[model samples]
Target: MKSILRLAAATVCAFTLLALQAVTAQQVQIEGSVNLTPFEARGITLSTLYKVDGEFAGKQGIAVPAPFTLAAPRRDGQQILAQAKPAGGGPIKIYFATDDPQKRIFSSLQIIPFTMKTDDPQKRLEIGDYFAIDLLKKLGENRTTRVNLRRQVTVGGLPAAEVVGNFVNAEGDQLLVRLVAVAKPGSPHGIIGIAVGHPRQGRIKKVEDIYDTSASLAFDTVTFN
Candidate 1:
């Protein structure tokens, strides 16, 4: 009778283990078929463009529509200014929140063309990472005091990189800077970079706030020709 009981207990344990394995297999199959990244699962779609007067309007080939107004151009007839002799590619386009350089917030956009093929998502992301780091360096010019955040993100359905840091400008004022670089969707030979800078204690107090505002106003609304 004792031997019979032992055999019964072993059978029950085997069945329980089999049941657990079956459940785990099912879960794995479900996850594989419905794979989703955290950002995608959260339904975050970043864009900087909006419609305005039935026409898209933003600097650097991006625009937006009504109910979304961009920061006032620095001065009349100079809403968009070009920065000459950029590190590479075409001149960088800049838009300022105010005319006063001491207390103003500014954002810039640039399109950098590349010769390498970037059809693969991973390759594109790698290129974007490189551009992002390069952009940060150009912005800081070796005077960065602290870096707050630097990580990968998805922008307009493309892999991108974002960097936020604090640096002292030529004017000797500490400024917060946010930069993002992403491969242009459907365009394998180009990358788009967007950057924002403001006084460290300016109206926008948080680095993430700066990033979010730029995304909604300029980065998210970009459209390439």
Candidate 2:
């Protein structure tokens, strides 16, 4: 009789787990991982990943794979003006929090440098385009990041150039990022905002149902070029 009770309990537990999984499956579908290190090069750590899954990834009649959603600021995402914080010292972890309704909010220690490249620990590479390619190659070993399917309008009001990158977090749940610069009004220099968050996908379209093209949001970054 005792054995029968234990078996019944196990079956009930399994059923609860499966029920939760079914509910979550109806929400966002988890896709492949993308490296946020490039963005991290810019000093942003991804807090969380949220993306449209299933038919949403199908995108109406357009083709696109799901895009990774990124972490939110302190608790508010889309904080374009926040400065990058360094990992004080600890481990960072990543997970999903759907209860927030707001953009993905992530909590983790600021990430330290992967290697002790400098005494400051904050400086790795300067902010600029093409700077993260090497880092991306190093980190993106089995990850397929979302990139530009086609050019769109840039902040500078010019035609969309190839603004691309991946979402990565090192030691913890930090947002790793590398973004291109957007010049202001033909100025030779401009400040670009960088942060770690998944693609917003407001009205974005996809190609071949392979991946949803998205912009990074987990960190704040600016290019010096």
Q: Indicate which candidate wins on TM-score.
A: 1
Tens digit of per-residue lDDT, candidate 1, span 82-112: 3322333332333333344332344444333
Model 2 TM-score relative to the real fold: 0.27
Query: lDDT for each of the candidates?
Result: 0.42, 0.27
How much lDDT does candidate 2 score?
0.27
> Per-residue lDDT tens digits of candidate 2, residues 1-225?
334334323311221100001112233323323344334543555433323234433543322221122333222233211112111210111222323344243221111112111222112122212222332333333264444322333432332122344433432221333333333233322222222333232322222211211233232221211
Model 2: runs farther than 4 Å from truth?
1-81, 84-152, 156-160, 164-168, 171-180, 198-225
- lDDT of candidate 1? 0.42
Candidate 1 deviates by what RMSD?
22.9
Point to the candidate with the largest lDDT: 1
Residue 96 of model 1, lDDT score: 38
